[model samples]
Target chain A: MRNLLILIAKYGSTLLFLFLELVCFFLIINFNKSQGEIFLHSANLLSGKVNQQTQKISDFLRLEAENDSLLTENARLLETIINFRIHDQENNFEAFENKDSLAIYKFIPARICNKTTHLRNNYITLCSGKNDSIIEGMGVISNTGIVGIVNNVTDNYAQAITILHSQSRISAALKSSQYHGTLIWEGSEANKLSLITLPKYAEISVGDTIVTSGYSTVFPAGVPVGKVLNYSIDGGGDNYKVEVELFNNLNKLSYVYVINFPEKEEKEQVEISDGN
Target chain B: MGTKWIGLIIRLLIVVFLQVVICKRINLDYGILSFAHIFIYPVWIMIAPTKIPRPLLITIAFFIGLFVDMFYDSPGVHAAASVFSAYARSMILRFLEPDIGYDTDHPFNLNKVGILWFISYCGVFLLAHLFFYYSVEAFSFVFFYEIIMSTIISLLFSVFIMLIFILLSNPKY
Candidate 1:
């Protein structure tokens, strides 16, 4: 007992070192609480500012595509107004009838400020946030298709877990057959994601469209994910490893939309009750 | 030894700043060489006070590493590697002792301890430091051979940088 005590007293410094290291390890593991949130929030803000500056510099180059989308929107609006007017004219003869087919959804534009595709858990930052009602878990979509899911929100900015993240498991389905599979990133490729657990019998082919399964409230039904690039079989079953060519060229993504589900709170209550 | 402490602090601050503000933004993908990281921060362990309390030294090393980790968005890697080096610093010093004993508690300088001793000391420390760092960063031995190769290359680069810093400071050997 005396020898043990003497030994402890002699090597106390090493013991202290071990203790400090363990404490540091614990802190690092549980660093996700509030400090991480603050870092991500600030990073999002800074990245957003940089992206905005870059976008302004590059806006002149994308004018043609922006003009094309605007023209298409304008044509659709004109056609809707004309059709509504004609229907109202016809309905006037049938006494009282409501004839308004106004579009409900409006795109709240925000720029992609910061994004990463190489990390295990990738995330993106947008220029818009709570000031624009860009709450957590909102769907961020580009003009081409789905971009990511919002995971953090501050007063002036929001951060998103992009489709390229290894941890991003999005519910997606084949456009033709509607066979649902979980879309996952394989941690190495930026231009591809693995669509796993697909049954072999499903008549899948290259160039087939992939879209959101709408299993979650975050994204609406039928938001495009990517086109199927390839498939293969594994020992367990026919695991189709899809090379998803993302719609939003993540490298070039500048603008996106933050979507809000009006019935989100009600849905959450229902989900909680269901769980219980 | 006093100047060494000042130099370590200054270099650490510069590395953290450069890594966070500069290197974090400069990722060039070269296939197998995926990312070329320049780690000049371990100069702290390379020049720390030889006789400081081991626990306090480890704690100081941990915080310095943790600060770097915080800025770079990678958790635990720098901290783990730095603590390992801090723990091994005294051992390396003990091993590199020549026929004449190091009388002072200060670090063995190039002039006092000879160039070969300093080189071997720096090499061993760099090897241990890089071994822990890359192993932790990779998190798997599947790329066992790759890890070994990367570790050697990284150590060589780190040693080159350390030599540059030591030369620039022109510390009284």
Candidate 2:
């Protein structure tokens, strides 16, 4: 027993290293499999707080740029409102009948407290959550284009799976031909996305605009998504895979709009009945 | 003795602050340079007093790495690399032993060890740290090419930064 103690005393460092490394590998594997939820959550919360403090200083410095962008967005929203008013006047007889369509999507503005763009699966944290009427599965968009969908929420903060995430599959269509496709990230460049399942015969070209299809209750119809960068025939040779360049830079996002679709529950209930 | 411990703690705080708050934010992703990440945190373990017990040194390295990983949003990749390099440090010091030998209480400061020896020592450990870091980060041999490329590129930048830091501080302890 004394000899064993001597041996341990001599090789204590090596033994400790082996043990520590074993623990580290355990963490790596478990975290990769997403089974380290408690660790990840607490880590995120702590880091989120540090990032929030840093973000405040940078946010103060970028106030002028933020104001300029907000002004342009305000002007664009005002123009849309004006157009709606004109359409309502033109269809005055039908306007009263379809009033629900006029206010289908309500936008809840939130600031991005923290985000990451380089990871295979990226997530964004917003400064608003359940207390602010934000909920899981609500679609998020910046002033420019689609940001992500809300995945988790606390009392005051929420997490979103950005479009850059591998599992993010947004329904999109060509603005010109209206050919439907699934938008997905290929885990390479930050700004590029792939639109798959587009029919081979669809009229597609470089610079063709892509927009939300409104098939899902998340995003409204005709929201700007991206522009086609290139296209190729899928391995199956039955569909066209078009590379899309997003309008939103994503890396520089500061503020976003969480889409609130009030009729989502009603639509989902109807779909469930149909399935039954 | 108490002062020495206090000095070490202060240096630890400074190094951690520099790595987590400053170096973490510096994106060197200009065209074709995306793979080069700056990591000087390993210098903390490298510059520690030579007489520190191996078990204690390894433990310090592990916790510091885990602290950095929290900010990077990666759980264990950094800790694994740091531990590996910390384990390898003693072997490296033995290999690079000078004719006069080491003063166990003092750190291998640039002035004490001379430029050539200090550079080689830092370079070798930085390379080991970064290689292990990228390998564990990829977590698969399928990305062998990516792992190699990132290690070499990051090594160059990290070594350069280490040289500048050593030259500036030239700490005796």
Candidate 3:
């Protein structure tokens, strides 16, 4: 009895160490993904608040760049408006109400509360949520290019799954050829993405522009995704993994627009009707 | 004794603040890898008075790592590594046991122990901790290269700042 007690006393610390390590490993192996997500979302509440405060301070230092982006956005908006006005003047004002009813896209402007581009499953939190009509699964984009898709929403905060995240796949195509493929981030460089699922015979070359295919309604067609850097054939030569350099400087982005498709539900409903 | 607790608390706060607020933001990315996070949290466990009981020391070490894990958004990784280092600490002390044994409570003090001894001791412990950390994060033997690369880079980066921090503090036991 005494020997057993002595043994327990002598090695108790080692036993405790092993026990705690076991618990931690269990958490790592079992809780690494889903459970960690819940904890992270809750932690986001605190981190989001901290990021907002620091973002304000950093925002002050970045006023010049912000002005430049805003100016550029304004000019682009003006050019499109001028193009529309010219077309309307040549045609008629009789169909103006019909054109208004056909308008499908709305943009919700929001500042990024917190964003991380360096992690495997990166997420960006926008400062607007349900209150601003920003719902789950809406696409987000910067003035420069596509940013991400909104995945979760709180009352006043929405978590976006950034393009830099692992498991992030978006439909994209060649701007010139319309050869559609999947754009994926390989958990590495924030500026680079891999466009895969391209057929073996697809004519592709460096610097070729890529854009959203609009196969689904997530993004409008011809929204510039990236420019091809290079490509290589797979071992079987059935497909190619083309490297693309994204236009959005993800690390420096502050303002983004969450996209709403007013006709998405109607489109889905129509697509689901019984075959004719 | 009260002063000792207060000093420990202050150092704890300093380490946590530097890690979460400052070091987390300093990403020296050359390419895909950004490897410039300086980990000063090991000093929290290292600075405990040598007279503290082994079980309690390990418990404290686990919690310290758990605290760091919370900030890093990587649960289990830091805590596992910290406990491993804590469990190995007594053996390390015994291996380097002096002719008269570790007599002073202030074993981490650089003034008491010479610079060489302090550096080598911290170096070994931090290496073990970093190796355990990167391995856990890599999560598989398939990423052996990544584990080794991160371990070596983080160890060198952290040890430099840790030595500087220790010199500046010049703690009294």
Name the top TM-score candidate.
2
Candidate numbers sorted by DockQ from highest down? 3, 2, 1
Q: Name model 3 segments beyond 4 Å from true.
A: A1-4, A34-276, B31-33, B98-100
TM-score of chain A of 2: 0.68
TM-score of chain B in each prediction: 0.82, 0.93, 0.91
Q: What does candidate 2's lDDT look like per residue over A1-276, in tens digits?
A: 999999889999999999999989887868754435544676788999999999999999998788757855663463344235434545553453345456556667788899999999999999899998999999998768899999999999999999999999999999888889999999989999999999999998899999988788787777789999999999999999999999999999887888887889999899899994
Q: Compose the digit string of candidate 3's lDDT tens values, residues A43-108.
A: 787899999999999999998788757845653453343224435544644453245443346567
Instruction: Return the lDDT, model 3, position A97.
Output: 28
Runs with alpha carbons beyond 4 Å of true place in candidate 1: A1-8, A27-276, B1-8, B18-35, B103-106, B171-173
Give the DockQ-based CAPRI class for model 2. acceptable
**Comparing to the true complex, what docking class would candidate 3 get?**
acceptable
* lDDT value, residue B25 of candidate 2: 84
Give the CA lDDT, 0 to 100, for residue A70 in model 1: 72
Per residue, candidate 3 scores C-alpha lDDT tens digits across B1-173 of 88888997898889878888888777888753565457788877776677778898888888888888888887788889889888888887778766765657667767667888877788888888888987777665667887787777877888888888888887787
Query: For every model shown, what is its TM-score relative to the native structure?
Result: 0.41, 0.45, 0.45
Worst 10 residues of 3 chain A by lDDT: A78-87
B45-150 per-residue lDDT for model 2 (tens digits): 9888877889999999999999988888888889999999999999998888999998765648666778898888988999889999998887666679889988
Off by over 4 Å in 2: A33-276, B105-107
The pairs that clash in candidate 2 are none
